[model samples]
Target: METSDKVIHAIYNDDDVLMAAVKTVKAKRFHIEEIYTPFPVHGLDKAMGLAPTRIAIAAFMYGCVGLTVATIMMNFIMIEDWPQNIGGKPSFSYLENMPAFVPIMFELTVFFAAHLMVITFYLRSRMWPFKKAENPDPRTTDDHFLMEIPVNHGNERELHDLLSKTGAVEINVVNNTH
Candidate 1:
């Protein structure tokens, strides 16, 4: 992250060209700071050498917690706290009344997983409520694509040449404060 001092912002018109530029820069062992695309570019993570996400594991654990909560809550409400006998069916034991709790358990599990996963994604991406967005170029949100490569070891000239060769319509060397 110290390489954030100076960054070469390369703008490409097409996603295919941008992807090719990513591969070329990675092949040269140049570290890419980030890429801003109008849409999600498939295989970009692999091209950037990013590790596989652990969010799925977190979601699974959250789901388990939800399931456990539902089970314990239903058991307490139906059996331990107040044993209800409705239509000749007595909620005396949890296992005996498990079929009734299936809907609650399933709903809670899905609810926790979906909601918590979104929170985890936002937190991991450093996105917070009312925070100023860090978009360097507004065009990336529309039809253009922007790739940020931090200039390290004074490789600004080399990166500029490489980016120009990779079909970048615009390249700017900027002093990155953030």
Candidate 2:
């Protein structure tokens, strides 16, 4: 669809003005494709009705997998492959004698969860190290609030008016050419 080349009408400037604009747009049930800002704005997610991220759940699942794998691997290697009794402790015992392995297990769990979660986030967000960053407006990263509205028939003028009323210091129509 040549999404990069698609025209985006943006409202730039103060965060408070952007917040009020977003509220107005959201209250009217207008679909906002995306919003860009220089810094994280508190409560913006809620105002946009974005659902809470599910990465935590995925991380927990990954950690559980890591824990299970570590436990089984250590038990098999230490008890079955090379059974050793340290300080006369029973080799077959897991809970009592395997306390030494707790650190390894915990580290593995955290490692797997963190790494896998990052990979998942990267894939899900369509981000890659070699790819060019999708910055709609470079100034937004400095000090601007950029709101992108998709081109739809019959809504351009109304959206522009709403953006103006929302106190947009500068509004520019851009074409995404990627």
Candidate 3:
């Protein structure tokens, strides 16, 4: 919980304005701490120049694990432990009965990929139970959008003026010592 004595919060009324402000701030070579919006804004990450996510690779690996488990379990149950005969057909070979296991494999693959991806996202975001909210302004959760910027010494006025020009509805300089 380190702190900064000079942090400015520039509040915006719309996402479009916020996006433009972000681009302007970046063009001016100012470091943006974070932005809070009530809803997801498309292309915001690209505007911020953040790297692409790798969640899809993780989901694929999880699906592979699920498929392997399903195949092994089905093979053992249908061909090894107790061989069952259906319609004068004996369950003696796993490869021959692979068609019957396709549905189970597909279901388990989807289930594992979905469940594990959700759990991974929650953990990665530090969204555990009973965690306190980190939003600085309550209004950001409802309708307002807040952009946080670190103010260097002697540049607070310039930053405020720039934010105002970028269509910020309100600006507050906060001592973020937390």
Leading candidate by TM-score? 1
* Candidates by TM-score, descending order: 1, 3, 2
Per-prediction count of colliding residue pairs? 0, 5, 0
Ten-residue stretch with the least lDDT total in model 2: 1-10
Model 1 agreement with the true structure over 37-68: per-residue lDDT tens digits = 99999999999999998988999999998999
Tens digit of per-residue lDDT, candidate 3, span 1-178: 3345779999999999999999999899888888999999999888888889999999999999999989999989889998899777659899888888899999999999999999999999999999999999999999999999887766899999999999999999998744
Residue by residue across 1-178, what tens digits does model 2's lDDT show? Answer: 2133445556567888888888998997777778889999998888999999899999999999889989998888887789887778788757765688999899989988999999999999999889898887788889888887765655667777877888887766666544
Each model's Cα RMSD: 1.5, 2.8, 2.1
Taken over the whole model, the C-alpha lDDT of each candidate is 0.90, 0.81, 0.91
lDDT of 2: 0.81
Residue 48 of candidate 2: its Cα lDDT? 92
Q: Which candidate ranks first by lDDT, i.e. highest?
A: 3
Query: What local lDDT score does residue 115 receive in model 2, on the 0 to 100 scale?
Result: 91
TM-score, one value per model: 0.93, 0.84, 0.91
Q: Candidate 3: which stretches are off by over 4 Å? A: 1-3, 87-89
Q: Model 1 off-target regions past 4 Å?
A: 1-4
Clashing residue pairs found in predicted model 2:
4-176, 4-177, 4-178, 5-176, 5-177
